[model samples]
Target chain A: MTTDDPSFSPPSFVPFERLCLIGLGLIGSSLGHATRRAGAAREIIGVDRHQPNGQKALEIGFIDTLAPDLETAVTGADLVILATPVGAFDAIGKAIGPHLSPGAIVSDVGSVKGVALDVLTPHLPAHIHLLPAHPVAGTENSGPEAGFASLFDGRWSILTPPEGSDPDALSRLTAFWEQLGATVEIMTAAHHDLVLAITSHIPHLIAYNIVGTAADLETVTKSEVIKFSAGGFRDFTRIAASDPDMWRDIFLSNKDAVLEMLGRFSEDLSVLQRAIRDGDGATLHDLFSRTRAIRREIIEAGQDAAAADFGRRPPSRADDSKF
Target chain B: MTTDDPSFSPPSFVPFERLCLIGLGLIGSSLGHATRRAGAAREIIGVDRHQPNGQKALEIGFIDTLAPDLETAVTGADLVILATPVGAFDAIGKAIGPHLSPGAIVSDVGSVKGVALDVLTPHLPAHIHLLPAHPVAGTENSGPEAGFASLFDGRWSILTPPEGSDPDALSRLTAFWEQLGATVEIMTAAHHDLVLAITSHIPHLIAYNIVGTAADLETVTKSEVIKFSAGGFRDFTRIAASDPDMWRDIFLSNKDAVLEMLGRFSEDLSVLQRAIRDGDGATLHDLFSRTRAIRREIIEAGQDAAAADFGRRPPSRADDSKF
Candidate 1:
C-alpha cells in the first residue's frame, strides 16, 4: 500500500519526447491509443505502407501525426513500436535503420519474439534499444478500427529484453503498460517464445486446423458438422477467425516451440483415446472430475468471471458496451 | 410448397391427451418446454426419483403436473418420455414396465439409443411403441430451469427407431419436434449411436482429459493457464462443465462406439503430431485448409445461426422468469 500510494499520487506516466508506431493495424492502433491516453509521449505518430491505414489512424485520433513512409516515421522519434506481422519485421527494421534516433527504444508486438529479435537486430543501428513484446490479449477481430483503449485491461503484456539492456528503457516500458491496466512480465526472448508456444500459439494453430478440417468435409457431412456445431465445434470457429496474415507469420516463425507443444498434446490425447477405446469409464470419469476442479481454480483466479457452474449465467450482455 | 396453405391454419403439432417425462434434466426440461409451447399435451407429469426436481419443474411451469412416484406419472399417460441418465435405462424400464399404458408411444432422449432400446424394450409392454431419440443440441448446463423456449430452435433431433416400429407413432413424434423448429432425421439406433460417439462423445472426452492435465499442474502454472485461456483451454472448459451424472451415463452406455471413434481419432491425431514434429509445414497447411472448408459447408447448410458466433450472449439475468 505504501509503494502504491506514491505510484498513484502524482498521476503521471513515463514521458517520451517522441513516439513512432509502424504499421497501424490492430496492435499498432491499440499501442497508439494507450501511449496517447497515458501521456507517455509528447507526440505519437504512425506510419503504414498502406496509405489508407495511416490516414485512417490519423482520422480516428489514434495518432497525432502520420508519416507517409518508414524512414520519415522513425526519424527523431525517441521510442518506436513495430506492430506489423512478423514476416514484415525484417524489412521494416532495415528500412528504418538509418533513420532511428540515437539511444531510441524500439519494441514490437509480434507473437514470436526470438525470430523477431534475431531478424530485427542485425539490421538496426547499434545506438538504439530493441525490446520485443507480445500483449497476450485480442479478440479474433482485426484492423485499426477494432483497436480499443481498454483492450489490454487486466491482461498480460510480456517484454523480452536482450541481455545487458538499458534499465531506463525497460522500466519505462513496464510503467507505460501498467498505466494501461495490464500486468507486465519481463523475460528473455527465448523463454517468451517457448511460454507462448503452449499458452497462445499452439492453441491458435489447433483451433485453425480443426475449423479448417471441419470446413473441408464432404458436403453433407460438413453441413451436419456446422449445424450441430453448438455441440462443441463452434468454439473453434472464433479462434479460427483470427487475422490470417498475423497467424500465418506466427506459425511460420514459431515453428519449433509450437511443434514441440503440439507433440505433447497429441501424445496426451492418444493416451486418452486408448482409455476410451478400452471402455475405461473409470479413466474418463476421473479425468472429467479433475477438469471440473480446474474450472473452480479459474473461477477463483478471476480469469473466468462466471461462477464455475454453467447453470449460473456469466455477466451477460445487458449492454453490448461491456463486450 | 404444397404443405403451405392460403387459409389461416395453425401449425399441426402432435397432441397427447396425457404425457409423462421420466427425468427433469436439461433435455427433459427442454422437451417439456417444446411440448408446452406447442400445446402438445393436455397434462404433462414428471417422474424423477428426486421428488424435489418434480416439484421444481411444476413450480417453474415447465410441467403441467408433478407425480411423486414413477408409476403415477406413467400409468395413464398416452406418451411417456424417458429422459433419465443413459446408464439408468434398464432400471427405469423395469420399474415402469407394468405401469405403462397400453398402446402408449414411449420414446427417450438418451445419447445412446441402441443401448437404450436393448435395455428398455425387453421390459416394456410389447403393445407399447418404443421410439428412441437423441437431440443434437444442449448447453453445458443441466436441470429443469436451464431450459428455454428457443433451446431446440433450428437444431437436429434424430429419432432412432428399431425395426418394425409403428408408422403412426413416428409421424406423431416427428410432428411434435417440428413444431419446435427442428428438422428430424430417422436412422437405425446403431448408426445414430456411432454418429454421436464420433462427433460429440469423443470430442467431449478429449476436452475433459486436457483440462484435467492443465488443472493438475503446479498452482502457478495452472493459474497462468487460466489467465491466458483465450487460447484453446477456455474452449475446453465449456465442454468439461457438462453435468457429471449425465456424462457418466453416456460413457458407460455407449462404450463400444465411443471406443471405435477414439481409435480412429487417435490415429489421425498422431499423424498430425508427426507432421508437426517433423516441421512439415505443407502437411499442417493442408490439414488446416481442409478443416476451414468444412466450416464453410456448415454455414451454407443454414444449420448454424450466425448469432451463435458470439456464444449465446452469455444468457441474461434480467430474465429469470423460469424460476
Candidate 2:
C-alpha cells in the first residue's frame, strides 16, 4: 500500500459466495456497495434489527437480499461481518454461532478491536475463524442511503485477528479489503484500540465535550455559537455530529485507552491554561507553531484533504456555496 | 442581509480616498484585494514592519503603494485599518496617532474586540473616530500571498463601536464591510468577546492542546499519529495550524472570557470522562444527539458550506485525490 510499491497490482482471489452483513448502517452498507462494485461477493445478505434500514439497503442495491432473522442470514454464509455497535457483538455472536457454516470467516467493522475480541471470541464457535477488522474511514453520515462505493478508497483497513488464526482465512480477508480499495494493516487487538484511542476516540470525546460546553454557556447564546461557528467551533460540530450510539459504545468499550489519552490531554491543557494566565506569549506561540508541522505531515501522508479550509467550495461557486 | 429582504441592493457609500492598512497579513491583504475589487479605495497604502511582506503586498497588487514608516502611512489617509496582531495594536496606535489626519476613521480587524477598544482608544486623537471591527472570517493560511478577494463574501463582520462614536463614521465602516460582501452586526465590545470566546478561542485552545498531547504520547509515535489522523484528529489540525502570533494575542487579550469558557469546557469534559469510565452509554448518546441539531442550524443559516465531507471534491476527481 506504500507509494514505493510501483509493481503492485490488485490481488486475484476467490470472492465470497455468500457474505452476511449483520448491521446495515454507514459501514455495513458501504461495505455492501464496495463489495458489489468490486465483484468481491456473489450474494450480499443484510440483517439489520431495524426493518426500514434492511429494506432501504435492498432498494438502494446495497444488498442482494434482506434476512428477517440472524439465523437465516448466517445459515450458509462464507463470511459474516458484525457491523453493529460494539456492545451488541456478544449477543450477536452467540445467536449466529450455531447457524454459521463450518469454515465461515467472522469479522467486524468495530472501532474498539480489543473489546470486540473479548466479547465475540467467547461466543463464536471454535470452527469459525474470528477476524476483527476496523476500516479507518467514514463520513459523519449514517444509514443505508449515506453509503457509497468509494468511501473506502485509499483508506486504511486494520485487521486484528485472534492468536493462531488460520493463515488462509487471514489472507482472504486481507485480499477482500484490498479489493474494496483499502490498504490493509495487521496488528494485535490491543494495539489497534490504543492507536485509535488517540486518533479517533479521544478526539471525538473532546469535540463532544466542547460543543456541550458552548451550548451551556449563558453569556454566549446558542444562536451566537451557530452564527460565528466558522471561526473554529463548526469543525468540532461535524465530528461531534457522528452516530451517537456507535460512539457511545466505542468510548465505553475502549475506556482505559481513552482515559489515559484524556488524562494526557488535560495535563497539556493545564500548561496552556497557565500560559494564558501568565501572559506567556512565547510558550503559546511555540506550541501553536509546532502543531502546524503535524498538519503538514498528515497532508503529506495522504491522510487528509490538502485544500485550504478543508476543501470547501469557494464563494465564487455560487451554485454549490450554501450562502 | 436576511433572506426575506426582497428589495435589498448593495449599498453605494462614499469610498475612502486613501486607505492605509497597518499590516499586510491574511486579513490585511484580503481587505486590500476586496476593497480594490469593490472600488472602495482610491489608493491602498500598506505598512508592514517586515520588508519582504511589504514588497510582496506591492508586487501582488494587494496594496497600491508601500509605506516604509507608520507616520508616512497615516499622514493623509482617510481610513487606517490596524490589521496587525492584537498585541501590536497599542504600540501601532501610539506611533500613528499624531500623524492621523483630521476626521480619519481608525478601525481594526482584530479577533478580540474588547482588547482592540481598550488598546487603540487611548492613543487616537479626539477628532478621529475609533471603530473596533472583527470580520468573523479567515482560513488557517496566512501571509500576503495566501489571501483572496472573496474571503469575506457572505461572512459576518462584527463592529464594536464605543459609546458616543460618530454615527456617520460607523455607517461608513459598516458600508465598507458590506461592500466587501460581509453582513454587519454591531454589539458592545464586551459581548463580542464573550461570544467569540465560546465560538473561536476555546475551540482553538482545545485543538492545540489535543494535538500537543497526541504528539507527546510515548506509546504512540508521531508517525502513527500523522498516519491515522484521518480518524478525527485531522480536523483539529486545520484549526490548530492557524497563525501562532495572532492566536497567542487572542488568548492573552481575551483571557478572562477564554478562561471562563475553558473552565466550563473542563467541567463538561469531566462529566463525559466519568460517563465513559462508568459505561454510562445513555448519557453519552443523549449529549452526542443534541449537538447534531446545532450543526444543522449552522448549515441552514449559511454559516458553513453544506456539502458532505466539508465540501472536499469526491475521490473520482483524480487531480485533487491524493490516492
**TM agreement with the true structure for every prediction:** 0.83, 0.95
Residues A112-192 of candidate 1 have per-residue lDDT tens digits of 899978999998878989988888767665678878776676667878889888767777777777777666667777777
| Local distance difference test values of all predictions, in order | 0.71, 0.87
lDDT of 2 by residue, B147-216 (tens): 8898898778998889888877887888898889887777889999999999999999999988989898
For candidate 2, the docking band is medium
The best candidate in terms of lDDT:
2
Give the least accurate 10-residue stretch of model 1 chain A, judged by summed lDDT.
Answer: A314-323
Tell me what fraction of the real C-alpha contacts between chains A and B each candidate also makes. Answer: 0.30, 0.71
Model 2 over residues A163-226: C-alpha lDDT tens digits? 8988789878888998998877778888888899999998999999888888888888898898
Question: What is the Cα-based lDDT of residue B146 in candidate 2?
Answer: 83
Please tell me which predicted candidate would have the highest TM-score against the true structure: 2
Stretch of 10 with least lDDT, candidate 1 chain B: B314-323
